[model samples]
Target: MQLIIFKDYNALSQQAANEIISLVKHKPDAVLCLPSGSTPLLTCQLLVQKAKAENVDFSSCTFIGLDEWVGIPPDNEGSCAFFFRNEVFKHLHFSASHIHLFNALSENLAQECAAMDSVIFENGGIDLMLVGVGMNGHIGFNEPGISFDLYSHIAPLDETTTAVGQKYFKEATELSQGITLGLKHLLESKKVLLLANGNKKAAIIQKALEGEITNALPASIIRQHSNSIVMIDEEAAVMLT
Candidate 1:
């Protein structure tokens, strides 16, 4: 695991984008596990700009969503699919057929979870996974106490997670659970890029990187992975030293 602290968000985003572009260039068909939410917004924009300027081809790349809020329709503005369509797919050269998204509303959630895990396993696992640490140290919707052995599954959202996520929707939305590609899958990736920013994330970031490994702080499990890069802005790294 490597921790990289940047002076600001722009620097962090650019570096992260460059790393992703490099991986894609090296392996055009690389399977990527992508994250949702505000943390990766700038990184996605930087990727769009870089791809356009460099004429990078992402048509052969495969993108898999990290997680999705249970019961949220794809058309919902706060949905993970909606975020990918607006923030990622719309900005890249990727083919629609190459994108694999989670079905949050499936009547058979267990089967859906198994299907997601099978896809990743059959595709030779993820080559790269872009992730963001939650303020409470959760990764993907895998909240505190979630077992590290689990793969893709439905996870109950922590109260803290739901409260923080409510800001993304215009109206009051009840988000009780999420379908997430688990830590086992994320750690199986050939490389993982974990991102965090803002002063609000400082203390948690410090604990996740420097503290003991524990399921209570889900992101700390990244330490067990052979190849993991943690990128944070100055404010988020304030507690590091």
Candidate 2:
């Protein structure tokens, strides 16, 4: 695991965005596994601005969402699909066919999972993965428990995750099932960037750093990732080193 401690969250996010921009500039065809959350929102916006100002080309880039909320429509603002579209896609010039999002509301969830898995395989896996750590140390909704080494499959979510995710939903019941890329799929990425920001994430970040490796904290599994880069602010990195 490669850890990068920054002076503050903004600087950390900017640095991350800079690196992503460099990658895209050099390899516009790279597939990027994106995350949907406040932590990556600013970074995405900055990247779009940078692209616009410098005339960077992203026409060949492919954007793949890491996860989506089950039963939530793509138009639902609370869904990851909506988040990615409004926050990143609409702002960039990426090819529409290159952008991929899993239909969590599909009646045939099994088929959707298989199709996503095949798509990832056919694309030769993700080249760059952008991720955010949850307050419960969760990544891509792979809530800790009974799943230490998993692929793109269904897994139950922890109550804490749903509760925290409710901020996007207008109703509490709207926060329930989540479809996430398994730990195995995440580890397949050639390069991984995990961001953690705010005091709200301090405890979980510390737990991921100090606590023993266990299924209870899925984010901790990144420690075993071959080329994972973890960036955090002073508050989030307080207990990391």
Candidate 3:
């Protein structure tokens, strides 16, 4: 794992966006797994701007959502699908066939998990996975105590995750479970970029980076990935040793 501390959020977002742009430019058919949240909002915006300014082509790239809140419709403002649709997909004009996202409302969720895994496998695994670390040190809804051995699966949301996730919605929404690509996918990805920002994330970022490697802190498992980068702003890196 490599660690990079940026001067501020904007710098961190730029670096993240640049890395993605470079990846697509080098490998037009790169398969990506991306997270949705406040931390990645600026990064996604930057990607759109840079894609246009630099003439980067993303039409051939494949996108896979990292996770989604169960029982929510994709069109719901709070859903991960909605976040990507407005932020990256529409802005970049990504081909519909190149996008694969979890159907949170699917009645057969296990089948949804299988389909996700199948897609990842068929695409030759994820070329790059960009994720945001949750306040609780969770990555892609692989909350505390989640086994790193698992692939795509339905996860029971931790209380901390359920509570913090409310900020995504305008009105109160029930957030109990999440269908997500698991830690195993993170490990298997050819490259991984983990982003975090704000003072609120400092302590958890410290724990995930400087503390023991354990499933209790799911982000810590990134330490074992052959190629992973943990990038954070000064505020989020404050607690790091």
Candidate 4:
């Protein structure tokens, strides 16, 4: 894994946006797995702006959502699908056919997992995966103790995840499970970009970078990936040794 620390959040977001734009420019059809939530909001916004200003065509790229809360509708404000639609997809005019996201409302969630795995496989695996680390060091919803060998699966959300996830909604929403692409997919991706910011993330960022590679800290598994980059702002990198 490689680490890149920026002076501040804006610089980190700009660099992240630039990396994504450069990938799309070089490989218009690049398959991407992206995360939702506050950490990536600025990056997604910058991406939309730069793509529009520079005439970056994203209609050809295929997008895969990293995870979604179980039982949430795609249109719900707190859903990962909604986050992408409002922040990136609608603005970029991404083709519906090129987008693959979890249907958290599906009766057969196992089938949903299978479908996601199929899409990733058919697309020759993910070209790039952008993820954010949770306070407990989870990636996607792959909480502590989740097996790194698994692919797309339903995960039991960690208590920390359940608590932190509430910030996405306007009111209290019970969040217990998540359908997510597993760490296996992240490991197999051609490139993985892990983004973090704010002093709140400093200690976990340090652990994810310097701690031992173990399922107890899912983000630590990124160390095993041949081409993974950990990009964070100075505040988030403060605790790094």
Model 4 spans > 4 angstroms off: none
C-alpha lDDT of candidate 3 relative to the true structure: 0.94
lDDT tens digits by residue: candidate 1, 28-61: 9999888989999899999999999998899999
Candidate 3 ranges beyond 4 A from true positions: none
TM-score of each: 0.98, 0.95, 0.99, 0.99
Quantify all predictions' global Cα lDDT against the true fold: 0.92, 0.83, 0.94, 0.95
CA error at residue 4 for candidate 2, angstroms: 0.9
lDDT string for model 4 (85-166, tens) is 9999889988999999999999999999999999999999999999999999999999999999999999999999999999
State the TM-score for model 3. Answer: 0.99
Clashing pairs in 1: none
Error of 4 at 211 (Å): 1.2
TM-score of 4: 0.99
Model 1 TM-score relative to the real fold: 0.98
Deviating ranges (above 4 Å) for candidate 1:
none
Best by lDDT: 4
